[model samples]
Target: MLTRILPPPGPARMLIFITMVMSLGQGLWIAINAIYAVTVIRLTPGQLGVSLGITAALVLISSVPLGHLVDRAGPRTIQLWSFLSLAPLTGVLLFVQGFWSYLLVTSVQGLAYRAGNNARKAMIAARVPAGDRARIRAVIRAALNVALAVGACLAGLTLAWGERVGYQSAILLTALCFLVTGLLTLKEAPVPPVPAAAGAAFAVFRDVPFLLFTAVDGLLSTHGLLLDIVLPLWIIHHTDAPRWMSAVLLLINTAFVVAFQVRAARGTDELKSASWASLQGGGCVAAACLLFAMTGGAGLFMACVLLTVGALVHALGEIRHAAGSWTITYDLAPDHAQGQYQGAYKMGVDIGKMFAPALFAWLVIGHGATGWIVLAVSYAVLGAAVPAVVARGARSRATAKVAAGGVTSSTVRM
Candidate 1:
């Protein structure tokens, strides 16, 4: 059973193990950070918001440069240093007293986290076979979700304990997780750095088709905020469903992803299939939005049913979207520049998320069903456009190859 679910004993399995450990730490931090900031640190909600915004901005600013560094310095070496940096940075969170200190610590932590993530993706590109990359990513994501859930449960226990010591302990434990992940990274074989040509450090920015696809894909990725931020508010304020149903919805989404994500990822190794998966996934999410909108003003039983069904559909979309996005990002990038390309993709997603909370609050929570309809339409339109966008990217790559000289077999297929 373990073999069926996990990669064989090799670098891929090692990577998955590292991902699980890292995600466990993130899960603990994410679950309790806001409460710690508000209650322990005595920061107001507005101050917390500012800190988060600044941290995100710092992540955006640092992503490309750090990823470029990963390419030049080697993925394994950069990833080890990034993880080591995170250990101290996260530990410093235990000492945050006010907004400024909190902001400074978290901003640095975010940058280190982004650098580690970019290097990890590049490592996968370097180590995993092309045919297995998407599947392995899906497996890693599944492991991540499971580990995060476990970590969140651990955080919950700390919250229930209701002591300053418990919170501090969780922070220390998360720091330890980072340290362990860094040490574990040492076991993986070293990946050679891809030397970059002078004046071509940021060439990915010039790939217009890739940038466009990243933008559209980033917009679609905002569906996550819908589940995390929008749904809880919608259930509590608008729908007749019980508040606990929100937790239930999250459980359903997590379980479905763990069970089906690898299966959904199958066949996404190719551009055409991956594009189709994105379209289909988008349609499912759009349908889920419409379903969720209908829950407004519904009776308790009817609302519960709609929420359950919508959650399942949303999870389906989530996994498919993830699989397709991984493939597209991997395929679109050149072998030598995977780190920077992945960083660009991460930047796009982060930019979308930065605005998603406010946007969803205004449109979905503020405007109610109307907001939901707008989101549905946006997802559907964007999802339908993926195929064309992918084709255009393929054509552009092909043109570049031909212009350079004779087209490669891969270019001919594109």
Candidate 2:
């Protein structure tokens, strides 16, 4: 377990270190940014929401273009920019007074990070063997969990006293982290030479099977948000469970992710295995929904027990989904156009982020616990389709050659 969970020393391991440094900074920002915004920036809730909305929109817009650049130039160069540009962007937070400055700086900051992350995925595909990519991603994800945990804990000190000083210190620390990581990336992260590519920027859209696969992946990305958003509401409004259970659900998620992500990643190298893993994830989610529904109108102990089981099941689904999705994202991408492919893949995730919250709320909040039944049925249907869809994606991946803005008809799902 230790061997599997711990990344072996190499570029992947070093990459993990870089990931840890960047993640720690992000963790710090996540812990304090909201309070800091309220206290230091004096921004309204509307401004904050709009700023984040614009940031998400920018990321969606840039995903493909950044991927194209990554393919042409190389992921290392893009990541170098991700790290470097963020340093200055983060610094601009100090001067932010109104919505405009906050939006300007935060949007730029978010875009840089998004581009870097998309490039980082390409970089992993480039550097790590396909068989190892899931495990390596697991390591990175685990490290991020650890970093965020530590960062959040440390940020609590600031929360206790010195609100203004604490906010500035935390933001400065975040900026410094980006600077230090950028410097380290420049000095140490080895850049593999990019292979030349000639293809249409929109070639990914032409691959029907890949698009289908990406659609599944995008939906899969919403699993994390379930615990963060949906579960809380369900506990509050639908279930007899206490609101505090939401926090417990998150803790369960983080603990399981840190403990079992690598273990869950095992045997995901092949498309069939990955598809199977994904199916299992969907089933877990389906079962979890049922359990969550059962939490309604139950005795206190039973409701808590049912919710716990549901959350734990959801965590497993999250782990399985992560491993399976990471496998396909790396395995199916054409090496020459990895950046573009990854960018396309990321678009699916962004789609989930942009839409899943609203969709889930409509399903549950508007419809009630019966809405969970609807979700469960849909998840099972989607999960049941995985094997066949994967079989189709496999054929396409085997025969598909992306040429200027489209794929061959042979690559389309049969």
Return the top candidate by lDDT: 1
Q: In model 2, which regions exceed 4 Å deviation?
A: 1-4, 187-189, 193-196, 401-414
Q: Give the TM-score comparing model 2 with the true structure, all chains together.
A: 0.92
Candidate 1: regions farther than 4 A off? 1-3, 405-414
Model 2 — which ten-residue stretch has the worst lDDT?
405-414
Worst 10 residues of 1 by lDDT: 405-414
Clashing pairs in 1: none
lDDT of 1 at 98: 89
Return the top candidate by TM-score.
Answer: 1
For all candidates in order, the CA lDDT equals: 0.90, 0.80
Candidate 2's residue-wise lDDT over 276-382, tens digit each? 88898988988898888777779788999998889899889888877877777766667777888888888888898898899999998788778889888878787
Give per-model TM-scores. 0.97, 0.92
lDDT of 1 by residue, 225-249 (tens): 8878899999999998899998999
